[model samples]
Target: MSTDPHANQFGELAWFKSSYSGTSGGDCVEVAATPAAVHVRDSKRPQAASLTISAEQWSAFAAYARQA
Candidate 1:
């Protein structure tokens, strides 16, 4: 088992699927916030790889997304 506390750590995470995510379950993205970082994953593949981005980076990404 991995020693990393954040590994396989989706449980209890307040995952919020993007507003753009439709009921058809296509192109769905989920985000979770942590004290030290922001976690992003695909809703269709919850157990798959996730992207761990720093809070600052996440904020920048969010700002960019808003403008896009």
Candidate 2:
């Protein structure tokens, strides 16, 4: 992550909607990639706050989701 707190530092990340997102356009999460971390936010509110997680942590979370 860069010293800047703004996600804009990521420079136009290719955001992707989660596969589990409902087709009805309900609650959905989106994610974008940075060099060292993944940035996540709600698709309904792109201007809202986002959470940044380390690549390893994101991988662990994905693994846990698959297990569940």
Whole-model alpha-carbon lDDT for candidate 2: 0.81
Total clashing pairs for each candidate: 0, 0
Shift in Å, residue 48, candidate 2: 0.9
Q: Candidate 1 local accuracy as lDDT?
A: 0.78
Q: What is the TM-score of each predicted model, taking all chains together?
A: 0.75, 0.77
C-alpha lDDT score of every prediction, in listed order: 0.78, 0.81
Name the runs in model 1 displaced over 4 angstroms: 1-11
lDDT of 1 by residue, 1-68 (tens): 65543354544567788666769978888888987789888888887777889999999998999999
- Model 2 misplaced regions, further than 4 Å: 1-10
Candidate RMSDs in Å, in order, are: 3.6, 3.9
Candidate 1: residue 68 Cα off by (Å): 2.0
